[model samples]
Target: MRNHLVPVTAAALVAVSSFAFAATQHHATGSVKTYDSKAMTLSLDDGSTYTLPKSFKDPGLKTGEKVNVAWQQSGTMKMVDKVTIQK
Candidate 1:
């Protein structure tokens, strides 16, 4: 029984580790829908919208433009990186 339990525990640990490895990282890429500098908002071309943080300080983002949004997980999700005005 002790010998059998060792293999079973090791197998279970491997299974759990595999699940963690398969987890998806945070990422999203889409065209810019709307970027309101005053409103601090960003709307992607994918019919999705996100509000920019007040700390965000950049330019050259406009409506109907292309953008690649790279975000980080913060409870919900927060934009940590972005590439705007891309083809």
Candidate 2:
């Protein structure tokens, strides 16, 4: 029982740490290479892809437009919560 305690505790810590990292919100600015309203995905000119939230409102995004994306990582996907077009 004592030997099993350490590994279990370590596993719990790893699980918590993974959620902590995932909760971190990230921001990026780039030119829009493509925007798919139906698919709800945004691709930057630099090759980074972000998935827009389902309830997200359109910010009048267009190809070649500069935007600031606020997103969070969910598993393998970067989910965008907000988008601000740059003047």
Candidate 3:
């Protein structure tokens, strides 16, 4: 019984880890509509908005600037992982 329980627990852990790793990462390209430095949020022309992590720094982002954003969903928020200003 103990041996069976151990295998079952290990399998459950593996399933949970796989699900966590399978969270989709997304990418988008659009012109910036707004950037709130204080709020750490960015809105794009495509009607998508993202919340930047606190550790993220502005890369001279401004309204109407073209950018490519890489992000992933974290609970109810879309968290920005990377941002690149498009020339």
lDDT of 3 by residue, 1-87 (tens): 987998999999999998988687899999999999899999999898899999998999989999999999888889999999998
Q: Provide the global lDDT of candidate 2 against the true structure.
A: 0.94
RMSD in Å for candidate 2, one decimal?
A: 3.2
lDDT of 1 by residue, 1-87 (tens): 998999999999999998776453455678776677897767777776565677887657776666777555445545445444567
Alpha-carbon TM-score of each model against the true structure: 0.53, 0.76, 0.78
Estimate, for each residue in 47-76, the C-alpha lDDT of model 2 and write its tens digit: 999999889889799899999999998889
Worst window of 10 by summed lDDT in candidate 1: 73-82
Badly placed stretches (over 4 Å) of model 1 are 1-25
Q: What's the C-alpha lDDT at position 81 in model 3? A: 94
Which pairs, if any, clash in model 2?
none
- lDDT order of candidates, top first: 2, 3, 1
Winner by TM-score between candidate 3 and candidate 1:
3
Q: Rank the candidates by TM-score, best first.
A: 3, 2, 1
| Model 1 TM-score (2 dp) | 0.53
CA error at residue 73 for candidate 1, angstroms: 3.4
